[model samples]
Target: MAALLAARAFLEIRYLAGDARRVSEDRSPEDDLERIRFLADVCHNMPGIAQPRPWRPSRRGAPGSSVQQAMAKRPMGWAWHTAGPEKRAWMLRHIENAGLQWTPPPPLPARRKGPSPMTLRQRAGVLLGRWPVRPPAGHLSLPPEAHVLKALDSDAICALYEEAGRLRLGLGKGGPWLRAHLDADSVHYLVPDPASYYWPGMPSTRGEIDWWQCTALLRMCDGEQVSGMVAVLPETFAALPSTLPRRKQVRLVHHARTTERDTYLWGRDHKAECDPQLCGFVPETTGDPPPDD
Candidate 1:
């Protein structure tokens, strides 16, 4: 009975780990649920094997000490501990091998593409209803080091920023708003932090330090939920010379668009109260800081 139980546990672990590998490689949330369901089913079938449980690492230190610790810490794979220590170690090795297999291939070198041009009217239409999505256009083409910024019509950027005001939610520290609205230029783009995503020139150029980059930063920052003090912030498009002129400094006012404000209020009573100025940080600008409002 013990031998059969051990064998069943091993099979269950392999199946669950395989599911986890698929989810990790594909990054499909649906796959994650499927993995969970499979694990639950395994626990149901293998009555002698301990039921799946959450992994809880020891607070003292030395994470991944035991199967219990590892399972507790992981978002998935809690069923590996059903067997003895030797079996658990074997299961872990298999899981590790699976991880190596799923390791993402190096990103294909970026080939610049498209004109990505839009008139002010078109930009407005994007902002009001749909996301501004156009491949590089005009001189822009795949291969050359060129990029374009398309503006979304809705105040999605502003809304994301305001909601993140109270909570610090992100893969890491508080980051720049991935979505941004410019009262000065009346433009929007996706601006993510240079550090968050893997890129060639992350520290130097902030991983695509352009208009779209800034917009994504605002959007990312806006959605981040912070439990403790925010350690880092994503780069700002508002401070970028490409987006904002050097001689001019723009005040990042809390946007007055009631619809977006109400939509993404960070548990604030009044959306108007949610508006706060951007942090005081200088960009990689050549000249002195722009005049503050």
Candidate 2:
């Protein structure tokens, strides 16, 4: 894993250097940054590469160059060169002309009502059943709308991945659930490292998935808004006390109650009770540890 990661990074640096040399003949510094950013996004988003922050497309340059002129058009060679063939193909799906263009997938076929919790084996079978193991570079494709329906007929497999992340949060570390592999039945397969430990707004290397990040990803894929209720890993990885006592829990419950009440009163114009037991949140009146522990 480490070797593959190093090689990918080395390839990126080489590609950036080569691109800089090639484009320098006609482009300026600002153009170089834009190109680099595009390539970075492609590489960083790939499953194997680990980095914080995805590629950020920007047009600005150091103090004296062109400030805001629209960038010169170029083929997505930067993306193709840095990203693996699988990613290169995915990026191509979004390309319009030589640039990336967001094309919302056509409306999916209406979902079929179905059973739940298909195992890793089942999903691998379905994915393989639908497409060849590998397609030619830049030629790979998603199944047609009807076919996607048949393949992911139930959202359960993905849901299991999400649940795995959540369980990790309470456990405070990786365990069997976090290690659940994704692939056809009975044997091993690859799964992307959980995104929980990642810093928000940044790309992160592959590692055990974080529950909060899993929650967000699941919501994004399902096209739903994320809630603030999801908890983040503490900024510092300092060891915390194993568990708080009942008094602390009670205090937290009270604080949550008050906070919830005030929030509802001011925002929703409703007088709502803050139930420590029901909501698991303490009112502000009590200074307590976070309920997440």
Candidate 3:
């Protein structure tokens, strides 16, 4: 039973470590180490981490330290009194293997520094949604060696909107998005930070910087979330000497009409009113009732 429990416990540790790695996120090495230590608690058969069940807990019982009791007698397993080198090495190895930067933690001054002061608090904040809440990927920095357009003689660009209440909802009323079509299937979307998705480069580009700031708008070019929108954002379509070399053939498009595919709803605008008088009664027999057969 001990051996079996030990195997299951290690399996969970590996599973947890793997999960941490698989997520498309960056975490500090200290964070991973803290996780490793808590897992050690599983091997030690400590409280809060009760007897193994499904990885997702849906059962209730007194927490058992059967796994710890089992590991204590196994080869190279933890003993109740030993917080030794073996345990420390085991933790460091897992962190390193997970491809995160691991600095050697400072030597303990004979006092076992269980989990750090911030560890459990950080975990709590994560569960409570107070931490690691990623804000919208707001205007990420452009890639190095960013693409700059000398001119665009054959690209059509404009704004797109879903109809019905698009004007009321003001989909493109802010910093106007500059959409471009490089091909029949390649569509690129661009918008200034404080511009309108509904309006073009008018008051949106009247600000200090337009072209450089709204250069790259990464997005799904294909119908599904697959292709990216990539094109240059030109402020004005003028041909003065200074702006001649910069002027390109850009299509200035206006919103046409809403399509059948625009699945817009006005439920909020047209809600059914409730009457207190009608609440207590079933509907009265309309007009007449048929004679009983």
Q: Best by TM-score, which number?
A: 2
lDDT of 1 by residue, 1-293 (tens): 22344455556557556756665575465765665564445444344334444443221111222233333343234344334465445445554655543222232222122112344654454345422222322222111111222233226444444444443322222223222213222344332212223222233333332222222312223442211111113333233324432111111110111012211222222223323355222223222211110
What CA RMSD would candidate 1 show? 20.7
Report the number of the highest-lDDT candidate.
1
Ranking by TM-score: 2, 1, 3
Which 10-residue window of candidate 3 scores lowest in summed lDDT?
251-260
Q: What is the TM-score (0 to 1) of candidate 3?
A: 0.16
Measured with C-alpha atoms, the lDDT of residue 86 in candidate 1 is 55
* lDDT computed for candidate 3: 0.29
- Alpha-carbon runs more than 4 Å astray in model 1: 1-156, 159-215, 219-293
Clashing pairs counted in every model: 51, 25, 9
- lDDT per residue as tens, model 2, 92-130: 543443454543233222212211244454345444452
**CA-lDDT, candidates in order:** 0.31, 0.30, 0.29
